[model samples]
Target: MQKPRLIASDIDGTLLDPFEQITVRTAAMIRRVIAADTPFVLVSGRPPRWIPPVADMAGLDGYAVCANGAIVYDIAAARVLSVHGLDALVLHDVVHALARVLPGIKVATERAEPGPDSAGAPFATEPGYRNPWGDAESNVRPRAEVLGHTATKLLVRHEKMTSEEMSLAATELLGDAVDVTFSTNRGLIEISAPGVTKARGLAEVAELVGVARDAIVAFGDMPNDIEMLRWAGHGVAMANAHAEVLAAADEVTAPNSQDGVAMVLERWF
Candidate 1:
């Protein structure tokens, strides 16, 4: 493969190991890439606030595509460059739609206020909502109030359905209204505005930096990463990636536990 002009990677299961830590070797390789003047962008399903620690660990001080591509953030600057969010009305429609398809669905919303201090933006979840990641800062509000405002992304989970099942139900029910995908193996499904995806966010950044799609190499490990993998000039999927993600990638590398990202980068940069 040709030398990448820019490197874009997912955070949770692609760049971090099984323990959610960036190994010395991986960090060193990432720093090496930056030293060679290539822009390394963190593309993730995580909200903006969740990106800082990961960036700090990898020693990255650049841009990130957050909220599964609904947001573009500058890490070191602590500013939101742009946002493609879901309107409150659309979110309300989605919630009602899902409730009809799958009873007892819980909803959460992520809305990052635009500008330098998005870290304090509200993350609202309804009562009885179970945040698997243990987010204590989220405002536990009534579902009506939570769905009354625009959001960068919407998270919905069912008490009895799997993530895959939720994805299918949302896709068939909310087609063209929202983009549905899941980053975790659990029951939660993430929803974004139509056409908002890691690929869309990365494309916006590539245009800003004067890099073409063919000059970028992206790595990921989940269904949410599928569009990005297919969009990049060369897409590498970690061996431990979801089945659809593996099929979407151009090449498969070692799992994240084995430093898969670094393994692939070593051969090129």
Candidate 2:
């Protein structure tokens, strides 16, 4: 494998533990990676509003590829450098499509605005869509209000089916018109613009940081991280990652609970 110059990792299941905190070993190892002159980019399925705290927790302020691929955030400045989002019509159409296939699915929109992160500046999501990461500041607006404008990302959730099941049900209904992925193993799916993935977001970061794609290594444990892992020089899957994620990886590390990311970085650094 090429000696990597950049390191990109997915946040929830790949970097953060079950409780959403970076372990001491992981933090120390990330410090080591940055010390080795390689930027540690947090490529996640999170909205831009959620990046700062995670970066602060890691004690690293490298770039973050957030909202699947719709946002490229500069964590140090707490600003969005770029965004690729779905317009109101697109999201409305998606809601209709999913509603047809899966009845009563909850829809949440992370709008691109001000006051916080990305276009979903303050985050105006619907009531049924709980913030999976325990968000404290989401505006529980009506579903109509949430879908009234363009959004950096759209979140859909169902009371029953797992994310994979939801994906299967929406497969024909959603062909390649958009990018759909799940960070968690539950009934939630995050949607971004067509062809947008964390890999694209990281590409923007690469251009800014002057790191070649082949000189980068990435880690992930969910469908959202699939393209990113495949796009990197080394795509590592966590031992407890989804089956598709495992198949997509060049190697498999320990589970997140075991500090998988830190283990790999320790060896490289």
Candidate 3:
């Protein structure tokens, strides 16, 4: 097989181990790939603020496709190259529609604060929104207030529905107006602007680096990563990936705990 010119991998459950740390072997492989002139971009549903540390862990400081394809971040420079955010009016419309369809749903918006440094409370959740991660950076407000402005991503949760169910319902109701996908198995769904996805984000980076889709190898392990996995020339799903993700992938590698990404890259790098 021809070696890939670029390597893109999801962070949480694909690159990081169960402990949420990059293992020595994996880091070594990442550095080796870069040393060989291969660009490794971290494509994830995580916001830009959360990408730098992970990039540091992997000993890389290039570009990262963040917020499920909503933002392109430059790691070393700590700058956001671009953002395809959800407009305020559109967010309000989507939230209202979702609330009607999925009763008892809660909403949150992730706004990309202006300026280079990602300061301030960019995450706002509506009342009754249960934060699964107990994030301290979140601010609680009324539902209307939460959806009253533009955002990088809109997060919705329903106590009675799994992430998959919410994603399906949102996709059905919203159609092409927005992109719906979930990164975790928890009862939460991440919504972005129409056509915003990790695939789209990675494509932008690929064009910047002059790598074609046929020469890119991507790795992921969640439903949010399905589009990216399918968009790359080689889509590799981790062994522990969601069923939907596994089905979408061109091949399966070891689980995150076993350094799935490194396993696949070693073959080419």
Candidate 4:
């Protein structure tokens, strides 16, 4: 196969180690890829608020896929180039419906906003409410009051519930109105705008950079990354990746602890 001219990777459970930091080997390999004129984009389920720091640390100036592709951010410009958000009406209905069915769930919403006045600001913000089930004495606000605009994504966290269980519950509740997946091994569910996926975000980045999808190499380790891994010309699955992710990739590299991303770049670049 021809060498890739672009590289996109998921952050948690893929490129970043368990501590959520890039290793020296990974940083060096990223530098090598950039020096070769191959741009690497960080595609994550994280909100835009948490992407810039990671980009700065990696010395990347490209786009970032945040909120599981609901938003595409330009790191250098500090702006959002594209956003696929859930319709306000749909979001309200979904949130309310989910709450009614799954009580005690914690709902978190992420949205784009101006950077902080201080230097090195984090883009976007997360402001929402928490409501526990069977707590009639609680004074939690309504879901509408908590969500003011189009919600880029909704995060549901429940300590007693498993990620898979929450995901299944969300799917059953939202159905075709949204896309739901697990962003972490812990019990957290990520909800994205319908039709938004990591693969879609990477495609937009490829178009913006004038690179063919076939010239992109992607790496991932979770179910949310399956589409991206399959979309790239060279799909790499981390050794610690889930079985589905491993099966969808063209190859498997070492785990993040072993600098899997660096290992791939060292050989390919």
Candidate that would win on TM-score: 1
Candidate 1 vs 4: which has more lDDT: 1
lDDT for each residue of candidate 1 in 2-86, tens digit (9 for 90 to 100): 8999999999899999999999999999999999999999999998878999999998998999999999898888888999999
Task: Tell me the whole-model lDDT of each prediction, alpha carbons only.
Answer: 0.91, 0.84, 0.90, 0.79
Instruction: Write the residue-wise lDDT of candidate 3 on 1-269 in tens digits.
Output: 49999999999989999999999999999999999999999999888888878998898899999999999888888888998899889988998899898989988999874556556577899888886666666799888888877899999988788998889899999999999999886889999999999999999999999999999999999988999989999999999999999999999999999988898888877
Please give, for residues 1-269, the per-residue lDDT of candidate 4 as tens digits: 67788989999888889898999889989999999988889999877767888998899988888878877888888778888877667766776788797887766566654444524212222233332322232334455644556667766767678777888888987887888888665667877888889999889989999999888889999989988988889999999998888999999999998999988777677
Lowest-sum lDDT 10-residue window in model 4: 120-129
lDDT of 4 at 265: 79
Which is better, 1 or 4, measured by TM-score? 1
In the range 15-132, model 2's lDDT, one tens digit per residue, is 9998888999999988888888889999987777678888888877768888887888888877788889899888888998899889979888876533353343447778877665
Please give the range of 10 consecutive residues that has the lowest summed lDDT in model 3: 112-121
What TM-scores do the predictions have? 0.97, 0.93, 0.96, 0.87
lDDT-based ranking: 1, 3, 2, 4
Worst 10 residues of 1 by lDDT: 113-122
